[model samples]
Target: MAFQTTKQTISQPLLDTAASLYCSASPHPTLKSISDQLKSQGHLDITPLKVRRLLITAGVYKSELASQIQSLYDSGKTITEIMGIMHLSRTSVHSYLPYVINADDEETEEENLCQRPISLEQQKRCEQAMEQFQKDWKGESLWEVITAFAGCTFVTSKGLKFTYEVKQNRHGEPTNELVISRKEKTVTKATVIKAYEKLLELSAEDSEDGITADQAKESVPPRFPIPLSGPKKLGTFGASYLYPIFIKLGLITEYPMLSYFHLPFSDDIV
Candidate 1:
């Protein structure tokens, strides 16, 4: 007689319990421990290897480090930032990430694996630019709107002021920098006008203090989701800290072209 293999039918409740144990448990339970736990809880006759295989098939058994890496990436942290936080090499970070990160050839080369730290002079220049931006724009919300519209031009303008880009390695990638950009098909000329109109209404309500970034976001939530960092953080509700860069980059020059209606920067901001 030939030996036959049996197909085990795992319940949804069991899968949920397994996922909970894998994620919520301190130090994470081993497969054998999970299997034993399941067995004790009335899920009899399952082996540790079978439990592991089932979890893999269910797609809930991904590597913990890989999950963390992907979460950081989704939250807008740079590859370098992820590596530093995890204390792993760039290649290690790349390999663990679920999606492929677009790395330049230089980053992967053995001779140039580690990136050079930003020099004090370069850091100082960026700081100076940031200081100037703060002075030019006091309010956070209005500043965010202007920056989102201008994007790369604003980043480049800051670079021009300091003779180098703030994020040198990510000079051309506006979305990668410290700003919240609308996803494709989400923003349009009409939507931009509507946003400004809403801002003006909010400004009229509290003419003295003007509207906050949170207020703007609540009034007109963007089609794309913004990551939730904190109440004071940028990009939470279409607001950002890069407002100064936009101002320095001559965002005022494009105001006329942004909308046919009179949308004065001075009136909306400061």
Candidate 2:
């Protein structure tokens, strides 16, 4: 007569509970231990073989088992000792060891990575720029300063001049559009001051159109809109590049609703 295997019937909830217990337990309990706990506490009659099948079916057995093996190995346990504790053979232990080691190495690499340090000269130039920005800043929000500074032009090493323009949508909303142009870039504090002064000069010239300097200043806010609804808004791409400098100069204030919005943009400012 041939020997027959018995099919176990367990509920989904019971299997899920067992898996949860297995994951949460420190030094994670074995299938046999889980079965015993379920029978004692949960009052569910589950065999160790059934628990194993359930864990495997849930797709957690291999990874969880490997984690347990790795934890034991990391604690300086010998392979033979791990074999006795986890009931895994040398081949199984060897197969998972590389993954564990590689994971740790990747974590170490990430931790070691540091941000590139800003130079003292750049810091001085940034501070000078901020000083000019503050003297000319007439708008209510720091976002206005960011937009103005973003519009300031700087010449590249090859003498290619570039500047940014805050593009607005049809609804008069400022999108994340910092349109770069090859116009004469304002590289110095004097030039930035002159740029704003020139705007006021132009606004004065357009007095016949009823556009006062104050109105022109008010117009700057509309160039970078913050919706009256929803959470309090911050500046966009142009804002991110200037944030570190703003922090250094104590220009940024902490408010309940205010946050720094980081959007994708080139941080390379001349």
Candidate 3:
């Protein structure tokens, strides 16, 4: 299939409509149009640094980061390579795990799948980006993007009640944001108390949907420490060989070593 990408023009009508479309609610022609125009005009007045910020924010605020990341992946850059370009850290990298892993309950299948560990400087960039994100994303949730967060599971979304996480680049850094959504529940202008009520409702729903709902469980993720029902056995091979590995190989899972207690699945990690 032949493809043609048509960039938006610096049209006044589009500018007028952008506030409803863009989150910042800025009145100017959005970063998207600005980028489109710069790419169209190739003017130095729009500094490369500014253009890059526009690009990153467009990917973020406009909710296009995932597709941009996928494009990088399609080009064969390792996850680490992508991380450097995006400035994401270990948390951000793992957040993307849900999107990249295609196998069923198979963590091993995805093993050695990450590109490379980010360098110290690159990691610093990620940290800085995250700090900025914390400042800006304090009260807002993620922008809804296409093919973005494709693998990210929807935590919950019910008007005023909303929660989601986003992993993307911002100002040349990779970062993750844990977003708690807020919207007026309805025609009713939600007061602080009303908002709090909605939050409680959302919380209950999340507890039910999150860890409690076995049916809603994710297929593959890193294993956390599991709890055992009783005392563990310690011997020559150490904890490594003592507990049996029962979870499937494809996905990360914690096997119950004891009937009803809490412990790390890798009781073997000495």
> Top lDDT: which candidate number?
2
Error of model 1, residue 158, in angstroms: 57
User: Which ranges of candidate 2 are over 4 A from the true structure?
Assistant: 1-8, 42-44, 63-270
Angstrom error at residue 202, model 2: 99
Order of the predicted models by TM-score, top scorer first: 1, 2, 3
Candidate 3 local lDDT, residue 10: 34
Give the per-residue Cα lDDT of candidate 3 at 238. 13
lDDT of each: 0.40, 0.43, 0.30
Tens digits of per-residue lDDT for model 3, 1-270: 001122322333332333233344444344445545555655434433333333333343222444555576575444443454454543333333222112342222122221234345544544454344334321121111211222222211121212223334567543433232233121111221232222233333435345432322221221222222211221212112111111010111122222222312211101
RMSD of 2: 23.8
Tens-place lDDT digits, model 1, residues 118-221: 34554454445445544543234433333332322222222221111212144564332332232321223333334334433433354344656455444433
What is the clash count for each candidate, in the order shown?
0, 2, 21
TM-score of each: 0.22, 0.21, 0.18
Q: What number of backbone clashes does candidate 1 have, counting pairs of residues 3 or more apart or in separate chains?
A: 0
Compose the digit string of candidate 2's lDDT tens values, residues 26-86: 6667777777878897656566655654565555566655566568767544454454444
RMSD of each: 19.8, 23.8, 24.1
